[model samples]
Target: MNINIFRRKRKIIVPVLTEEKAKETLVRCQSCGNLIEYEDLRKNLKVCPYCGYHFRMTVSERINLIADSGTFSEIDTEIKAVDMLGFKDLLTYKERIKQTKKETGLDCAVITGKAKIGGFNAAVGVFAFEFIGGSLGSATGEKLTKLIEYAKKHKLPLIIVFSSGGERIHEGIYSLMQVAKIIQAVDSFKESGRLFMPVLTNPSYCGAAAIAMTGSIVIAEKGSLIGVSGPRITREVANKNIPGKLKQAESLLQNGFLDTVVDRHLLKTTIAQFLKHYNRRTI
Candidate 1:
């Protein structure tokens, strides 16, 4: 069968989104009342367009900004939690673990790795707040131990970025044991004469704050919360009105708990300088 058919070509219109188009909708800076483009804000690492105030960053973002490009080698990637007690609160412990894994793309709160800061090799560990409120559990403790061992073996300095709610309540005693475990790990690193620097981010409370303070050079982000207990708990236990910024980073600095309070905008540069100073001092 032969049939003559007239074929017509259809023109397809595709929509392309660009920064200029996005900027047509203005976003005011939280710190300063200045209109700016969303793309520009992100490009500047979430700093305020006018005031230069830094926005809170995620653990992964911090790692990417601090570590030298293409130098991050992750450690203890396969260590995961096991529900030994079968505990349950509002949700099953096992289900909670699974959900955290799915949400954070991590088996545990801490990600241990090796990376370079200002060309100096170091062991890096970053705690993910998205993972069970960055709880310190058995897995987190084990990873910290391994990181210390790795640093000691290679004679590399250790840098830990800490932000956690404290010990994992669901894990009970197992979680509490991490405090001793990580402290011992830090002690081992100290005995090896290696430098340990812990940079505390916002809400570095409970076990995270305790372990992070073990560093020889402890630095905290400005405006961060650094304490053993949250405000609610402190108020409940103290049975009094607590100051609004009682446990803030600045308060900790005033109390000599933190070695330094660093601005988030210059965090990477400051950390790099610290690593450089330590490398020179050790050598």
Candidate 2:
């Protein structure tokens, strides 16, 4: 018997989601351009096996991936966005909210819930980018505030996984104001001796990022963006070109901003370990 024959073969790379292939069973990887089976892609937790590109997930998917089965229940499910300032550009704010709700089955950008990760009870809040770019609006602000309160009252560790395109420009100043409100909530949680974890996902910038920066143990996905503003806007404001990787989570960790940058596959285990370590005293 040859030793080479016992070794497993590596997969060949292939194009993105848009390109067509002869067999419908194959799909291309977005980052590395490798062709992978749809089922295999899903089994890998949507992370590209070739390049380690972490794909975005819906709120439901995030919960199912992290929370123990039959242990997650959403709080504040009825909150909806308001058309403050009667905002209208290409589309009216009211219409945008309605359209996003219908499409995403989410009233706002975040889903606040109570769940047990690794058998440790915790309060979790996950942002859904499918709704209006996951921007912070009045309803989003309210939910964040309430989630903190619920966690503090229950004495459970809180995990807020955020990925936002910034403040809701559609709401004008009202959206920008949420930054301070959420920051205050973070302070309140800390004052009560509760563990607050802010997990940044892809494209996490702007007002939401400001609030998340205050987490007790700040963590982010490996390739996530972590900054106040995006590269284009920062360049325009500073009148200088920024490095392409400056806003990424890996860069932030190197710069002493993030506690750790974990891959999506290990996110649940890492968070659960943190919860167990901190939650023991309280329980």
Candidate 3:
């Protein structure tokens, strides 16, 4: 077959990006796709000032944003992840743990500590979602259980800043059992008349969602997703349409699922107020 094809050449237009406007001038908000200055974002605690999009923050940033300066004393820093079941997929579990630890500068996905929020002593745990999507493993469960016990023993309020996807499947069934261990520990802590607060961030699913639902004083960031399962799994397992509105913090707040929906900038003060009230009640 003989055919004549006429094609026009495509032009690649290179954007005339200036040095000031390259990376320093504007940082794009992931949710709203708005370019905002670094200083402006930092001033608002990494939240989108224009659209009020709550950005995911690092574990250190989370701690600093909530806890008072010079008051965070980390507990159980020695407890790191261990290889069980000799799990390997592309790399061994130990190798993945090592890589994640080296990069994130943390032993596990979760960090437990005693801190003074608003000058009221609290047992705080922050999950690092960057590390294995903040997966809950045996060590994570142990740390959380211990944190709860510590809170009960010391009569300190317990708060967990959660940002997790699900259980660490690398540990197999052991990882799946974490929620059970946590539930038991939480019940004990509650029996001791200790307050437990679970502050949820974006995409709090699986075990993290369980914690969010369990807390007496539950809080989530605005636009945060809170559910037992995310839409994908829920659609498959339940064989039904995923209700988009039901997953957001505002909807949950309206439905009385969440105690409050807080802005990242005001999170510190809101928690501080809660702590202050509890402290006064105890006194």
Clashes of each: 0, 4, 0
Stretches > 4 Å off in candidate 2:
1-28, 235-240
The TM-score ranking, best first, is: 2, 3, 1
Off by over 4 Å in 3: 1-26, 232-243
166-237, model 1: which lDDT tens digit per residue? 998878999999899889989988998888999998778888898888889999887788888777557656
Better of 1 and 3 by lDDT: 3
Q: What TM-score would every model get versus the actual structure? A: 0.84, 0.87, 0.87
lDDT values, one for every candidate: 0.80, 0.82, 0.82
Model 1 regions more than 4 Å off: 1-41, 48-54, 236-239
Output the lDDT of residue 119, model 1.
Answer: 85
Give the range where candidate 1 is weakest over 10 consecutive residues by summed lDDT. 9-18
C-alpha displacement of 48 in model 3, angstroms? Answer: 0.8
